[model samples]
Target: MKRERGHFSGSVAVIGGHDHVHALRRLCEEYPDIKWQAVVLPPDSTPCLFLHEDQSMPEGSFRIQNDINENTPTKVDIIGGPFSGIIYAVEELISQGGSDKARMALPSETLEDTPGLTYRTFWTWDHSTNWELSQIGQQEIGVFNPYGKPPGGFLRDYKRCVDFCSKNRIAAIVIYGFLRDSHGGVEAAKELCSYAKERGVRILPGIAIGSYGGVYWEGDNQYNLATWLRKNPQAAATLEKGVGFQICDLAFPLNFPRSDYTLSACPSAPETMAWMEEGVSWLCETFEIGGINIEAGDYGVCGCSRCVARRANEKEAARRRDVHGDYWSHTDMADNFPRLFNAARKARPDTWIYSEIQWDNLLDPVSLEAQRRLPVGGIYQHTTNRTYWKRISAELTKSYVEELPMQPNVLRCQFACQWNGDERTERYALNAPVFAEMAQLSYRTGMKGLTIWGEPSPWYATVELSYLAFARFSWDPSLQYEEFMSRDVAPLFGGMEAAEKFVIAANEIDANQRLPLERLEALQRVCLEHRTSGEVGRRWLSLEEIISRRIYMGE
Candidate 1:
C-alpha cells in the first residue's frame, strides 16, 4: 500500500505479547476509525509495529528503531522488557497527536533508554486532593472532595489518575482512604485495582495498622479499625488526660489542626496485633490490589502500660547503642508493624508490601533494629520532612542505601498539599526543577523510587509539568532539566520560548511573588499570540485565564 507524500493512512498492525498488545490496543481505542490488528510478527501487507520482549535487556530499559521513511508500509521495532517500555514506545507513537496523525509523526531514529529507578510512584489522599478540585468544593485545609453523582463519578476520577500515571510511566499510586461509602465502597475499589493493572499501573490502597478505620475506611465493615477499637476500648491507647499532639512543626501543624486522633490502638496489646493481622488478610484476599501501604498511625503513640514499657525498653537499647533521642514513633512502629507486615506478605507474596516510615533519618537504634528485622522484599518508604530534607540534603550518599532495610526504597514528599507550603498559594507552580533534583538524589543513593503528592489533576499546566518531570527524571535521572523543559514540555506551550515564559510566571506564582499588572497583561498577550486550536492551545489559554484572573483580582 502506497501512502500520500506527507500523510500515512490505513491500518496499523501491532505485534507483541499479551501485555504489549493490550497497551497498544488501549492507545488505539480512542481512534475508532483506525483499524488495528494483533499478530505474531511484522506483516509486509501493512504498516507494523513489533514489540519484542527481550529478557536480556536490563530492567526499565527499551530500544526503538523506526524504518518508516524507507519501508513502503512503514515499520517500527520496539524491543524491551515488559509493560513500562511498551507503554513508552506506544506513547511516543502518538506524542505529536493521536489516530492517523500519530502515524505521520513517526520519525526515523534509533533510541535506547532506561529508567533510573525501578518503581516510580505517586501518593495521594483519596478524600482530599485525589479527587477534582472546584471553587465551591470543600475548602477545608487539606480536604478537597469533588465527587459527582455516584459510583461512576468517583470511579471516573480514579481512572483519570490511573490514565495519567500509565501515560507517564509511573508504576504505582498509593490511595489513602481507599474505601469510602460515598465512593461506591469495596466493589468500586476492586474495579479500580483491576483497571489500573491492565494499564501497567499498580493501585496501592493506603491502610493504617491501628487507626484511620482499618481496611475499609468509613465503611461499616467488620474490619474498620475505629469500630474495632470502640468495641474493645481496652485495646485503645491511654494518653494523659489533657495530653495531645503539640503543633510545634511549621508545616504539619497547619495541615493537621485536628491532629487529635489520640484514640490509637496500643502497639503492645495482643488484641491489637491479632485484629490488624486479620483485617489486613481480609483486605488482601478480598480485592485484587497491587499492594498495601501500611502505616502505624502517625497521630500519636499509645500510652498504655504495655506500650510505655515497650517504649522504655527500646529507648534504653537505643541509648546503649549511642543512637537515641530521635526515636519519635520509631519505637511504636517497631512494636506494631512486624506482625502486620508479615500478614500482608503472607497474603500477597508477589506484591509490594510498603512500610511507611514516618521519619527520614533512621539513626535511632530502635529504628535500625526494626529495619533489620523486617522482610527483605518490603518497600521501606521514608518521608521527606521539609526541615529534615533541607538539613540532610548534603549528607546523603550511596552508603545511605545500607541504612535501608530493603533494596527498593522510595522517598515520599508533598506537592500541592496545604501543609506543604511550596505551591499552596498558587497551584500553577513549576516544580520540575525540584523533582529533577529529587530524582538525581534518589538515583544516586541507590534508591529505586521517588514519590510526590499526585492528587492534583494533570490538566493543570503546573501539575502536568510536575508529573512529567517526575516521570522523565525518575525514569532517567541523567536528563538535563532545561533540556527536558525545552524538548519535552515546550511543545505543549507552542515552543521553548513560550514555555520558558510560562515556567517563569508559574514559578513566580508558586513562590507567592507579586507580579506587576503590566507583566500579567504581557503574559496574556503572549498566550494569545502562540495559541493553537488543540489541547496544546488549550493549555496556553488556561494560563491566560490564570494571568487574567490575577490582573482582575489584583493579587
Candidate 2:
C-alpha cells in the first residue's frame, strides 16, 4: 500500500548511540524538509530508526517496517545495527521516497538488509595522485612523491572522498603517504582519522615495515624511516648491484613518470626491526586510526648476508618469478611481515591490521605455511599480479579457496593503475564487470572485503560506474549486473532513458573499439539534451571529454 505524498507530518525520530545520532543529525541537514530529531527515548507516535538499540536486531542486519494507513501520518520504524547500516537505511528511504526537499511517499513494507562483507574498503595514495593539488611539480602522479605542498585543496579532496565512501557504505580507506609535513603530519592525520570516524569510515594509514618511510611518508620528522636509516646506514637493505625498483611501465615513462619510492631497511637487521616496532607503536599511540595496512617493499629483496642466508632454503623451494623474471621469494615476505603484524597487534589490540601478500598465487607452500602462523585475527591482503587474474578468474572456486588459510582476506587488484600490465583498457574504461567478479569471489570464499584504486573522482563516468559497482556488489554480491546498472546506476545520470543512451556510447569508448562518427554524434546529442546545468550535466560533459580524447588519439 502506497501512502500518498505529503503524508509525512511529524518529524522523524532517531534513537541510537551518540556517534550514530550525531552522524544522522549531520545527514538530515541536507534533507531539511524531512525533519530528523535525535531522541533519548523511543516515541510512540513518530517514525524512528532504532540504531543498535533494539535487542532483537541481529548483528550486520537492518530492518525497515512501514504499515499502510492512509489516514494516519506515515511512520517507518527502521531498526539497524552499526553506524554504516543506519546510514544505509536512511539512504534506502531517500531512494524509495525522494531527496532534497522533494515530496516523499512512505509506503507499507517490511524490508531486511545486511552487508555481504564486514570490511569493504578502498586504497589510495595521499601525497601523490588522489587529489589535484596546485603545482606540485612531477610528484603528483605517483605514490610516495617527495615534494610537499600545503594540505589546502588536497585535504578537502580527501574529505570529499570520505563523504563519498560514507554515502556508499564503504567501511574503510587505506591511505598510503598518509602523513606529510605540508599536511600537518601526525596532528593532521589524527584529525582526518577523527573526521572519518564521525562518518563511520576508517582511515587506515599505510605503514611500510621496511620501506615507504616508516609511520610518516616523507618528512623531516624523527619517526620517518629515512631519518633513522640516515643515522644507521648499516640498517638499509644492500641491493644487488645495478638493481633498483623501477616505476616505468607501458606509456608510464612519459605519462606517469616517477622515481622509485623504495628505500627499504634490511628486514633481518636488529636495529631496523627495533626502529620499525617503535615507529608502529608511536603511530598507534599518537593517532585514533581505525587500522593499519602494512607492507614489505614490493621491489628487490635485501641481499645482505643475514637476509640471504635466512631465505636460502625457502627461496630455493619457491621457484616463483616476479615481473623481472628474477627469483621473488614469498618466504621473504612471510618472514618479515608477521613480526610487524605482531608489533601492530601489540600496540593497538582493537584496530584492524592488514598484512600485504603481493602475489596472485595463494597456494604457494611457503606463503601458505607462513599465513597459518600470522596473528589469528589479522587480515591477509592478496594482490593480483597484473594479468594473472584472467587465470584466477577461470579457475577460482570455493573449494580451491578452502585450501588456503581460513583467516580473513581481502582481494586487492590494480585495475586502472600503472601496475595493471594487462590488455584491459585502463584510465577511463569502466571495469564494473571485473569488480563484480572480484566481489562475488570474495563473498563465496568468505573473504572480508576487496580493495581497488580510489584516487579517481567519481565525475569520470568510468570511475563513477566503478565506484557504484564496487559499492553495490561489495554490499550484496548476489545483485545482478544489469539490475545494478539500471536500478542503482541510472539514477545518477537522471533516469533509465538517459542512462540507456549514455551506456550505448560509453561501452564503445571503454572497450577501446573505434567509435564510428555516428557514436560521437550520439554522445554530442546526449550532452546537448542533458545540458540543464548541475552535477548530472557535469557528468555528461566529463564523459564526452573522455570519448573525444580517445577519438583524437585515433585509438
Candidate 3:
C-alpha cells in the first residue's frame, strides 16, 4: 500500500463531553488562524475528529488513529480511557502542525501514545514566602502568613502555571501555601480546581499534618494551631534540653538555632491525632480538590517520652540515622501518617491521599508497614542527590511487589532550582541530564510518575532548557538528553552549531560555578549572530546580561 501525506485545511470538528469540547476550543484559540467548526457525526462526515471514552485505555492513556481515503478527507479518531488522554492527543496534534498556522500536516499512519508512568505530577510552592521571594526576586515578599491576603498577581501566575502543566502533559498539580485562609481562598481554589478539571488535570492542596500552620483554620494567626500548640507546651514534641530543634538538624548537622521551636505537634499525643483528623476533614469539606498532600513538617517527629515509647513498640530506634543524621531511625512519627490518611479517606472516599515519605525511611520496615496501613493511592518521594536513583528505583520496585499490595503510585519530586539561603547566585540549578536519567530509571523501575519542583523563568536560558528537556523526557523517556537538546533545544537557537555553543557554555558555567568574562562575551556574540528575534533569542540575550551582572560583577 502506498502512503500519502495528509494536510490539515483549517476547518476541524470535535465530538466529546463538555470538558473535551472546551479543550478543543482552547486548542483552536491557540491557533487562531485555524478555522474550527462544530458538527454532528454520520450525516456530516467532512474530515471529522471523533472523541469517545474507552475504559480499557488505562489511566493516562490516549490513542490517535488517522484514516485517509483517495476521494475522502482524513478522518482522525481520538480514543482515551480518561479525558486527560484525549487532551494529550490533541496537544500532540497541536505541537506537530496546529501551532504553525501556515500548514498543519498529519501522517497517513496511525499513532498511539501512552504515558510510561501513570501519575506525572508538578508541585508548586506558590504559598511559601521564601519560595515566592526566590521565584519572583522580590525583597518585600512577606513570610507565609496564610491569614494575610495574597500579594498582587498571585492568581494570574497560578493560572499560567496550570496552563503550562496542561500543555506539558502533567497529570496532577500539587499546590502548597495560603489556600485555606488567604483572600478568597476557598472560592479561588475551587475555581482553579474547576479550571484544571477541564484540562484533565487534578489539583491537590498541600496539608502539613506533622506541623501546625495555616492549614488548620480561617481565624486569626494567634488562634491558629501553631499558636495553640505553643500555649499548651505539653503537646509540643520534646527535644533534648540543650539540643536545638530544627528539621534540617535531624538530617544534617547545623549550628543555626531552631527556627521552628514548638511549631510541631507530638505524633503520639491523642489530642494531636484528633486535631490532624479534624483538620483534614475540614479541608475536604472546604475545597473541591481532587486530593490532599500530607507533608511531614520542617522537623521530623518530636523526641519526647511518648514518641520514644511508640518508636520502641515498633521495634525501631528513635534516634536519627548515622550517615544523614537528618531522619530518625525507626521513628514512630510515620505511624501518625496513617491516621491522617485514614481521616482524609473517611472524609472524602474518592480523594487521593498522598504520603510524602523521607528517602531514608523508604526501606525501613516500620515506614513500609505504615504506608501499607493507609488507603494511600500515591507515595511522594524526593532526593536532591541523583546518586541514589538506582537504589531508590530498586527499593521502590521491591516495595511495590512485596509490601504495598495496593500498588500505590510513586511520585518522584525533581528539583529544578536549589536555593541555599544566599539568594544571589542560587537562582538556576541546571540538571537536565539528571532529570532525563531519572525519568528513564522511573520507567525501568515500575514507578508511576515524577513531578518537577520549581517554576521555569523566561529570563534564564538554563532554566528554560532544563524545563524543556525534563518535560520532553517525561513525555517520552526513550528520548535522551542529547537527543532532546539536538531536536528541541537546539532549534530554538537557530541551528545545531548555535545550540552546541550554548550548551557548552551552559555546562561550563554550571560545572565551574562561575562564568568567565571572555566566555560571556563569546556566548553573547554567538547569540547575536544567530538571533532570529524570536522568544528563544530574546531569552538568550536576557540570560547573557543576567550572567554578566550576577556572576561576573557579583551583583
Candidate 4:
C-alpha cells in the first residue's frame, strides 16, 4: 500500500488486550478519515500499535515507542502496568495526530512517561447552597457541603466533566453531598458512578460522620444524634459561645445563622460513635462505590468535659507530641475518627477509604495517630496560595508512610480558581504557574496524587486552564510552565501571539492586583480583535471586559 505523504493515510491497525479495546476504538473514532482497523496480535509479525503489560513500568507508568522504517510498516508500542497507562498512551497519540508532525507518517520516537502521583482526583461540592459565602468577622467563610447535589441539575453537566477527566486520564471522581442533599438523589449518583466506572474512573462518595447537615436535623430533634443528646445533652460539643451541640460547622455564626445554636456531636460520646458506624454501614450498602470519603467533623471537634478529659490524658498527649512535634494537639475527634474508619472498613472490607484532613490539622498528633489506626488507604490535604506548610506536610506524609505497615497515599488538593460571589470574579485569579510548582514539589515528596477542585461551570476559562495545567504537570512534573503555555495554552486563545499577550496581561493583573488603564485597554482590544467564537474566546472576552471596567472605574 502507498502511504500518504502528510497524513495517517495507509491502513493502520491497533492490537491490545480486552482492557484496552475501548481505548483502541477511541483512537480509531478520533481519526475517522484515516483507514483504521482493530485486530488481535498474531504469532507472526503484524504492523500495529501493540498495547502490552510491562513489569518494569511502575504503577501508572507508560511508554510509547514508534518503530517505523522503510522495510517495516508503521508500528507503535504502548507498554504499562495499568489500564490507565493505555488510555494515556492513546491520548498522546491523538494529541500528536493533531500536530503537523503526525501528518507525515508516525514520527520515529521513543517516549516514556509516568504519573508522579498514584491518584489524580477531582472533587465537586454538589450544590449552590454549599457555595454560599458569609462574612464571619474579617474572614468570609462558606458552608462546605461535600455531599450536596450539584445546582442546575447533575446528569448533563456531570457527564461533560467525567468526559473531560476520562480523556485526560484522571484517576478518580469524588462527589460530595450525596443521598439526601443531592439534587437528583441517589439514582443520579448511581448513574454517575456507573458512567465513571465505564470510563476507567473510580467514584468515591463523601460520607460525613461527626457533622450532620440540617437535612438530617428534624426541628429540635437532630436525627439519631438528637435521640442520644436528649439522654445526655452535656455530651454534645461546646462551641465558641458555649452553645450546646451544633448541627455541624456549616451552621456556625457565618453561613447558617439559623442553625448556629446547633452543636456538633461529641466524639467521646458512645452514642456518637455508634451513630457513625451505622451511618457508614448504611452508605456503603446503598451505593456501589469504589470508596467513601470519611469526614470526621468540619472545623474542630468537641471540647466538652468528657472530650477534654480524653484529649488531656498525659500518656496519649505525650504520644501525640512525639509523633507531631510542635504541631501536635489533643482533640477527642482525632481519637474518635479511628472508630468511624474502622466501622466503615468493617462494613465494606473491599472498599477503599480515605479522609480529608483540613490543612490546619494536617500535623495534629491525634489526627495523625487516628490516620495510622484507620484502615484508610489515603489522606486528602488541601491548600490555597499560602503553602508555607507544604514542606512540613510532605515530610509528615513521608514519615507516616515509612512508619506504617501499609503506606497510605497522600492526595494534595487546590482550587483551580477562587469563586467570588460573582462568577466573573473567578477569572481574577489565574495561578496555573503557582499550582504547577506545588504539584511538582508534592510529587518530589511522597505525595501520590493531586486533586484540582472546581465546579463544572461553563464560563470558567481560567478554571479549565488551571485544570489542564494541573493534569499535565501531575503526569509529568518536569514539563516547564512557559512551554505548557506556549504549546498547550496558546492554542486555546487562537494562536501563540494572542496567548502570549493574554498571559502577560493576566500575570500583570495577578501580580499588581490591577493593570494600568492604557495597558488594560490595549490588551482588551487585542483580545477582542483575535477572539474566536467558542468558550475559550468568550472567557477571554469576559476577562477583558472585567479588566477594562476595573481600570476605567479607577478603584
Candidate 5:
C-alpha cells in the first residue's frame, strides 16, 4: 500500500467530492512536484481495463471522442467504485477553460503528467420489490410507503419481503422505518415487528431519522429540540433522562434533498452531544432501543460546534470545511455514539449498540481489511447489491467483507436489500456470491446474524432472485459470486437463457473480469438489444428490463 501510494508520488487526489478537493489538494501541496489528476487505475492491472485506459487512444480518460482512431482506445470503459472519484479529480485537474466541442465534450488527453490516484465509485441502488426496479427520488415506487400501508400492507407486502428473505437466505432484513414528518409510527412499528416475527426474518428495525428526507427541518428545528420536546412534553420528558447506550444512523438521505434529508447529529459537540445524548438516553432506556444502524454511516457535516470541538483531537480535522457542506459522509457515527452512550450509560448500563457503513467505508481498505472497534456493538455495513455500473467492475459489492474486524458479537453480514435501484434490470446489482462471501466474513467476525432489508418479496423476479441469492450466501460465503446464475436464473424466469444472460451481463459489466467490456456492452446494450434476439439471453434481458425499466449506460 505504501509502495502504491509512494509510486503514485505519495499524493492522492481524492475526487468525486469524497470530502472535498481541499483535503486532497493539501496533500498534493505537501508533497512538492507530485502531480495529481482524476485518472485512476485498477487495484491491480487487468488487460481488459488496461486496454480501455490505454493513453494511445485519441480521446483518452476524461471523455472519449467518436472521431478518434478505431484502434485508439475508443472508450475507457470504467469498472469499479472509483469512477465518481476519478471523474471529480479529472474535472478539477484539467486547466479550466472551454475547448472545442470534441475537447469540451470529452477530455482528449492522457493524465500522464498528472501523477496521483483519482478514485471514483459508481453502482446501482436496486430500490424495487420482487417486481421491477423503479426510479430514484419521487420517481421511486416505495419512496413513501415501501413496507406497505399497514393491516393489508403489513400482511401482504411485508410478507412478500419475508418470503424473499427466507428464499434468499438474507443475512438480515433491515427496515429503516420512522417517518420524521409523520408522528413516528408506533402502531406501524408494532405491526411490522409482528409480521417479521411471524415470517421468521432476522430483522433490525430502525429509523431513517433525518431521512424519509435527510434534512434539518427548520419548522422542526425551529422548535429547538427543547421547544419541540416542550410542545410534545411526553417525547421531550423522555429525553431529559439519559440511558446506557443509544444508536444514531448518521442521518438518513445521504444525498440530501435528492434523498430528501439532511442534518447530522454530531456526538462530539457539547450541545449537539448533549442533545443527542438526550435522544439516545430516551430511546435506549425508555424506548429500550440500543442496537441500531446508520446505513450511510456517520454525521459528516462537522462544521457544527460538536464537530469543531472534536476537531482538535483529529490531526487532519482542521482541513475539513468549516462551512456547512453536504450532510453525507462515510463517518463512523460510533465515535460520537460513545459520548452519547457515556451519557446514556450514566443513566443506564447494559446497552448494546450498532451502526451501518455505507459503501464500505469508501474504499479505506481498512474496514475492508479490519473494522474499527467502536462502542457500536454491531456495524451493519450496507452490502446492498446494486450492480448498476459493472462495466467498470463486477463483484464490487463483495469487496465489503474481506477486511472485516474480529469482533466478539456483531451481525457483520447484514445484507440490506436485493432490488437494485427501484426495479430489476439486466444489470446485476446484488450478485448472490457477494452476499455469500459477506456472510462468511460476518460469521468469521463473530457476527450475531444476518438481516436483509424490508419488502423483498414483490412482483419482480429480481426480488425473488435477490431473496434466493441472499439465502444461499448467508449460509455459505464460500459460494461463488456467479454460482448458478444461469441455471438459477433460468428456472426463475420460466427457464429462459436470455433472461439469465441479461442478469449475468449486468453483474459481468462491473465484475470486470474474464469478459471484455465492449463484448459485455454488446451483450445487453439495453432493453432493445434483447427485444428481438432469439437467444434466451436477449429475451430474458428484455423481460427483466420491461419489468424494471432501467437502462445500462454501458457495459
Candidate 6:
C-alpha cells in the first residue's frame, strides 16, 4: 500500500495494511510525535497490533517487547475491547463474506466451500440509556420509537415498537430487509414479511447488489425458485442456477459450523440476470416486499474472468445487448442488474427497486460508473465526514429531486450509535444527534423520508436519547439538534447542568474510549459512581435518569 505523505515521522513506526494506510495517515498527522513503524501488510494476514520484539520502532525511543512467543508465533490480538472495536471499524470499511478475513483479499467465487458472515446490530449493551431515557417522562420532553422489528421472529418487540409509533405519530418504521438465524427458517422469514405487510409498514429488503465485499452470486437461487414453484405453479426459474460457492452460516456465534447455506450472485455473472427473475417472483408472491435496498457496494472492481473479458472487449460488447459495462460492470457474475431488476418489475409489475450508492463510489471507477448507469432510489452514507449537517441535509433532499425520474422514493439512513453492552454507557455515544444532523441534511437535500436504525426496545440511556432525538427531528426538521437535545436531557436529569455535562463527558468518552467492555465499564462508573456527600447519594435517581444526566449533561 502506498503510504500517505507525512504520515510517519522519523520516530516510532506504525505497521498496518494498505486499507488502514488512510487511517494511519490521519492518526500520524493528528499525532505527529508518534513515529509509525509503518509495517504495511498485504490485504491478507494483517497483524492487529504491530508492536513486536523483532520489529523495530523508529528512533528506538519507544521500548519494544523483550520476549517473544516464538513457539506459537501468534499474530492474533484477541483482547475483548480492542478486538470488538477493530471488528466494528474494519467491518464498516469492508464486508464479511462468510469469513473473518474477507477483507484480507478479494474472495474467489470458486472456493472449495463458500464463506459467509452476518452483520447486524440485533443486540447491544446500553441498558442505562434505555432506563434513563425512560425515566425522563413524556410530559417534559418528546420521545419517539425510531425503529421496529421487521417481518419475522422479533414479533413481540416489533409490535411494541409499532404501537409506540402509531401512538407517537412516528412517520415510518423500517421493516426488516433480511434475516439469517437458527431460531427461524424460511417459513419464519415468510411469516415476518407477512406481518409487516399486514400492518402496512414499508419493508427494506437488502440485496448484495454490486459490491465485492457482500453476497453477490453466480445466480444460484434455485432454492428460492424451487420453493416458489412447489408452492405456486405459475412461477418459473428462468435461468439455470449458476454453479456457485454457497454460504454456510454458523448456527451459533461460537459454533460456526456453517449450517445455513445461501447463494450470493455476482452482478456481471450471466446467472445474476436469471437469479433476479427467480428472486422477484418469489419475493412478489411470498414476502410481498415493497422494495429492495442495495447496500454497501464499495468492493471495488472485479477481476472475475467475465469482467476481465468485458474490460478487454468493452469495444466488442459495445454492440451486444445486455452487455454494457456501466450496467453490468460488477464482473461477470452477470451484472445486468438494471436489466434483471427491470425484468423483475415486468414480472411482478409493482415492486419498487432502490439501490444504495455512496459518495465513496464516486471515487471508485467500477462503482462510480456502474452506479451512475443504474440510478438509485435511496442513498446511504452519502457524505458522512466534513460536510455540514445542514449542507448535507439540503444535498440529501436534492438527491431525491435529481433522481425522482428514475427513483421515485427517497430516504436517508443514519445508524444510531450502537451498544457497547451497557445501558449507561461510556463505551461511546452509540447514536448521537447525528440523527438530527441527518434529518436536517435530508430535508435540506430534498429527501422524501428518513431511515433511522433504532428500536423502542430498551438498551441504554443513549438509545433512548437516540430514539427521542430521532423523534424530535422526524416531528420537526427545523429544530436545531443541540437545542432539542438540551431541552429533553434537562428534564430527564432534573437539571440542565447535569444533562449538558453528561453530553460533554459522553463526547469525551466516545472520542477516547473504544473498547466495548471498557467503555461500558467507564460509562457505568461515571453514571453509577455517585457524589459522596449525603444528599446526592440518598436521592432515588434511577439508573436511566443518571445515565441521561451523564450523557446529556448540558446537552
- Per-candidate local distance difference test: 0.68, 0.69, 0.60, 0.57, 0.36, 0.37
Best lDDT goes to which candidate?
2
How displaced is residue 526 in candidate 2, in Å? Answer: 5.2
lDDT of 4 by residue, 1-555 (tens): 543322355466667646576576676677666555666753234457778867566655778776666666666788865536677777776776773422424544677777776667776644431222221111122444333323335566566776777787677766655444234555666787777665556677665554543113222333334454666566566642332222211212334443531446666678667766776666667666667666654444455667657666554445433542221223443465566667657776655566655443444333344445444454544332234345454555555544542245454443333432122333336657756876676676666666666454434455557777777888777789888988778878777887777777666666564556777677677768767787667868766766777777862
Candidate ranking under lDDT, highest first, comes to: 2, 1, 3, 4, 6, 5
Q: What would the per-residue lDDT of candidate 3 be over residues 303-328, giving only the tens digit for each residue?
A: 78776666664334433433344533
User: In model 6, which runs have C-alpha deviations exceeding 4 angstroms?
Assistant: 1-153, 156-181, 198-200, 210-221, 224-264, 295-302, 311-335, 343-352, 362-372, 375-430, 449-452, 455-457, 486-498, 514-555
Task: Give the alpha carbon lDDT tens digit for every residue of 448-476 in model 1.
Answer: 78878776676677778888998999988
lDDT of 4 at 328: 21
For model 2, the local distance difference test gives 0.69
Q: Taking the tens digit of each residue's C-alpha lDDT, what string does model 5 give over 223-322?
A: 1343333333322111111111111212122221321122233333344444555655554443323233433222334344444443333323322233
For candidate 4, the TM-score is 0.73
Top candidate by TM-score: 2
Candidate 1 ranges with C-alpha deviation above 4 Å: 1-21, 30-34, 39-60, 63-83, 96-111, 130-151, 240-262, 313-328, 360-366, 403-406, 422-427, 513-533, 544-554
Q: How many times do residue backbones clash in model 6?
A: 83
RMSD of 4: 7.0
lDDT, candidate 3, at 263: 60
Q: Is candidate 1 or candidate 4 better by TM-score?
A: 1
After superposition on all CA atoms, what RMSD does each candidate show versus the true structure?
4.8, 3.9, 4.5, 7.0, 23.3, 25.6
Give the TM-score of each candidate: 0.83, 0.86, 0.82, 0.73, 0.46, 0.48
What is the Å distance of residue 268 in model 1 from its true position?
Answer: 1.7
Q: How many residue pairs clash in each candidate?
A: 2, 0, 5, 18, 91, 83
